[model samples]
Target: MQKHIFNIHDVVLFMTVAECFLLVIFQAILPVKNQLANRLLSTFLISIAITSACILVLWNDDVSLFTAFDEYLLPYFLVIAQMLKGPLLLIYVIALTEDAFKLARRHLVHLIPAAVAVAWLALFQIDSTDLRFRTLGMTETERQIANGVWHFIKIMPFFYALAAVNRVRLYRIGLHNQYSNFSPTEPSWLNILTLGFLFTWSFSILVHVIANTVALAAPQISDLFGIAENYIIFILINALFVNSVVHTHKLLTTKPEAAKDKVDEKLTDTAIQKVQQGMEIQKLFLKQNLNIDEFSKRINLPVKEVSAVINKHYGTNFFEFMNSYRVEEAKRLLSDNQHADMTVMDVLLHAGFNSKSAFHRFFNRLVGMSPTEYRKQNMNKEVKIA
Candidate 1:
């Protein structure tokens, strides 16, 4: 029998596991209309909890307890649970971004990896006597095989993260094409989740490498890595809770038909010229809530072709192209004595922007200065010139 080595790290791991489950319940009862996303996210969070549970078992450091657990599938579930994190998160992104998204039988394909993981465990990974897989006693070939399997598990998140990021990019492109102004903050939740997934993947790899190296010399220090990972999980879980409260509902929209990038070399230079003329000469950009469809009809071009023309010629989506013109218009207004009495909010609103934060972000990105700074600098120059 092995004595349970209780430590402070156990407290953090327990809280993380408990919070994961708690968040799942909250998602289940969350009063949002996007129940599909809510449910999918809940399942994803539960899988996270399961992963945390497996680590919690390891943190327990009790071989007697492991022997008791090995009587059932509990030991195998640690590996099985890990195989689920990637698929669950990717599908949850689909559900979150697509309003009409329905879980189809085809999505069952994701389960194949989980089944394979189970088989891999049963075949190569189970050193049944000790109820653990990796050991100092493993042959060189056995260690390589085990490391290969774990590497495959670790890399799934990266592959899924790439696909998930592409889906989100298309979704945002769709929004920006149809809506003149994205508010209250350019889908910050989706942005956070995507960046968060990437950050978590990188951070885990860094921690794993350093911990394995340190473990070679001081084995006990390895426990600290588990503690750090659990803390990260806790923080992400709480971050998701915050995002759900503030940002989840914004995802319930369809991708516009022409939003997906398609190069059209044959879309005549004349057609591209027409879009530019409409924005520059007619000042069509000043129309509040301008959309590709409306501008396409006004220019007498198909929306798809118009989108292609912008993508091909200007190297920007409709959102950026329109905002560039709007930024120009705002600059003109800001530097002019004719509109000197107008506030920054007034100038942005009149320049076709709905959200002040969104306007400021675009302004800073395109003009390399905040509106106030740009205004003051130009106004001072006008003073000097006078």
Candidate 2:
């Protein structure tokens, strides 16, 4: 009993369970919103949960824990989990590369075989004389039913191989079409998801094949091999949770100018109206804490359109325009003798500079001198007056 409690396998099993729960929570709260990556992520998380639960039931100490369900229920779960990985990966690739992802009604047909396998396994387990279950393990001659299920699920490698090649072809098409225009440091979250899932699933299938092949020769190594399945599920869940949350948050919290650049695709007929609106909008932007999106909306132009117009016609982007206004305000603050003792950063912050680096960069570019240099020039005048 003590050995069972301290088993390495049990530790891995619990960790896998914990990861699945956290993944579920992340899925519920931090959904991918409009992104297609979320669909793949959801499928992967569900697959991990199903896989982990199957393992847990297989390794459960007492048969009474699932007395109503026969031993064959375990293989059914494994088969379903195995079948899900390929389609999830294929869909992930589609979402990453394709702008439009409409799931055809026929995709559901892929699951029919797995469903049939599960139902057959269930029937055999109930009828003690069933050949497949008997061969899989319920009888005294074959005690390791779970290991047999692992062996049976290995057939999914064919599905994975087919999907992987198809994904590569689709990815090439995506490159020529939508993905060709994306800049390297731009938020390519779907690309990340596509590549990451494919790499992970490929490695997982390789490990499963190698482990099972070796186990056929040396049965003792089977326990060690079983451990990999649980570990893979744990890693996949953790990756999904961490990567999805980080990528989603980064995209959502991206700088306003950066977000604008992402949404601007073409020059259109409304360019004149946008430019005129931007000119009027520039005045209100001088106010501290002015929101770009709100200003754009108030002016009845899309934010990206307003940003593009300002960049093209006004000769400056939104950040530069806003910071220029702030810097002018800061210059006014500096000229006032009453606040002469304030630091450059303090003046900048009061005038809406979010960072000293930003203030320094903008000041040098626009004013042709550093803030400190300007202060020294003013000091020389003050000294001359004194």
Q: After superposition, how far is residue 187 of candidate 2 from its true place, in Å?
A: 9.1
The digit string of per-residue lDDT tens for model 1 on 1-386 reads 97656566677666777888888877777799788778878877887777777666754555235565643455466666776777777887778776578889999988887787678767764543324344668776776665555565666666677777777787786776665666635366777776677677666666666654787787666656656766776788788778876787765465437335434756777887888788878888888777777888988888878878777777878878888889999999999988999999999999988878878999999999999999899989989999
Let me know the TM-score candidate 1 reaches against the reference structure: 0.78
Model 2 quality (TM-score): 0.51
Ten residues in a row with the worst lDDT in model 1? 125-134
**Clashing residue pairs found in predicted model 1:** none
Could you tell me the lDDT of residue 95 within candidate 1? 80
All candidates: TM-score? 0.78, 0.51
Model 2 segments beyond 4 Å from truth? 1-3, 35-40, 60-64, 70-72, 126-152, 161-169, 185-217, 248-386
Report the lDDT of model 1 for residue 10.
72
Predictions in order: lDDT: 0.73, 0.58
User: RMSD (Cα, Å) of candidate 2?
Assistant: 9.8
Displacement of residue 348 (Cα, Å) in model 2 is: 28
- Give the top-scoring candidate (lDDT): 1
Error of 1 at 357 (Å): 3.6
